[model samples]
Target: MTGTAPNRPEPPLIAEPLTLPGCLKIFPKVHRDERGRLVKTVHHETYSRYGLISSFREQFYSFSRRGVLRGLHVQLPPAEQHKLVACLQGEVLDVILDLRTDSPTYGQHELVPLDGERGAMVYMPPGIAHGFYACDDSLLLYHVTTQHAPAQDAGIHWNSVGISWPDSQPVLSERDRTFPSLAEFASPFRFHPEGSPL
Candidate 1:
């Protein structure tokens, strides 16, 4: 005698919410059973429904312990990357900085609480700085439109932006610790240069 297969569950829809510099893009929530849980990071159709263009070229995942701070990082023009960052395991205080001098929100900031349970994602366009502090043991998954470029990568000191970071002595890598304050470095991204692609 042959046995019938069980029906599969459908993924939840992505949610977009308001933020200071850009929208908060979210992946669908996953339901679990005795077997396991399932989640989808990107669906072209769903992203399109929200006016998101551009293809994902690379994927990255980082794990951080509580009170760990990652970055206020961004790549320069010609290597600028748009990212979709989500918390997959725990919670974080995600922050973004608007670097577009021409943008109405220039020098603005946004903070959001992201976690595995919320399944929230942040979509950061080029010309913005992004960073986060792990509020709990956290796993962050990011999808990028461009591959990593060492020379083009740049950042501002986490404390330079006037945002209050929860960790006073957060652990940081040598590279992350070496970046100059926003005012100390010459920015590589311009809002309206004569030949810019924007």
Candidate 2:
């Protein structure tokens, strides 16, 4: 008698230019069994093949309640980070702003609706600032190319960029509320048409 073959799972899907140059939205494949589910959020080879940063020196995560907004943040160059962000336990409205002064998309913004159950991920290139609004009690994970440096920390004011945030009064840390508006601040980052130094 012949035996039946085992099942094979499909690979994840990667959608590029989710809004800005080098930005990507990844839909990870989730395999479910009686035990639970398994997901492969990163494939180093695939990332490298697409010219996305694949080396992550640090990993961190955050938990936030609905109405909480974190960021509009980035590390200054010499320590700027390329991050892979994903929602792990709820939902969020993920946002990014292009701060590369010479790029055509500079000062532009984009939003990606992220849901933990779908396991989608966003790749944010070095010259962009990022933030998120919790749509529910949310958990977000980050794989970053550089370690955090207190002195290099910086951000643009969240409301200054004209983002249509869902909440009128978001709960914010004092620091997040204090960054200068984009127009008043001068960016040190310059867009490199060839590619960013990895």
Candidate 3:
């Protein structure tokens, strides 16, 4: 809610596909003026057209200093989530992994540049795991479709995958660092194609 110009009508969000199926790089419309800028991050009508989950059940953000890396995570079956993640105060090298066994891009990963200043976001389906490396002191916002379910929460170890992190010594939480590597993770989330919602 930092930037708001309610009187003006914002354009619809622009969605671009990433290498992985169901993963998208989104650019919400931003209006600028002599004072500053106004960003419209969500619109149910426009978002739903792209198959994004607009009825977010939870919304929060995280602040990370440079060299901090977080995630490669998702929830299990019956508690999976669709996410719209954005960087609101800095930039990050965002990473997304496709975990759907049936997906053509299964086990494939993609790198996206999320910038706070420019206002970019990523939309990921349930069968994907996401993580990021802060290139600056970044503030990341997360809008998830499902509430947190601790028992179903899970993740793959950061180093297990072949991602080339910007920092070899990124600050990590015990849980993120200790997650099972890609080879050890047994994914329970499944994918549905274009017209379907998982």
Which ten-residue region of model 2 has the weakest summed lDDT?
Answer: 8-17
How high is the lDDT of residue 112 in model 1? 79
Candidate 2 stretches greater than 4 Å from native: 1-9, 196-198
lDDT of each: 0.78, 0.87, 0.86
* TM-score: the better of candidates 1 and 2: 2
Mark the regions of model 1 whose C-alpha exceeds 4 Å error after superposition.
1-11, 190-198
Worst 10 residues of 3 by lDDT: 189-198
Which candidate tops lDDT?
2
Shift of residue 33 alpha carbon in model 3, Å: 1.8
Which is better, 1 or 3, measured by TM-score? 3
> How much is 1 displaced in model 3, in angstroms?
42
Better of 1 and 2 by lDDT: 2
Q: Candidate 3's residue-wise lDDT over 1-198, tens digit each?
A: 769866865556888888887778889887789998877789888877766778999999999999999998888879888898999988999999989988888888888988977898988888899999999999999999899999998998888878888888899999998899888888776668864432
User: What does each candidate score in C-alpha RMSD?
Assistant: 6.7, 4.0, 6.2
In candidate 1, which residue pairs get closer than 3 Å at backbone N, Cα or C atoms, i.e. clash?
A: none
RMSD of 1: 6.7
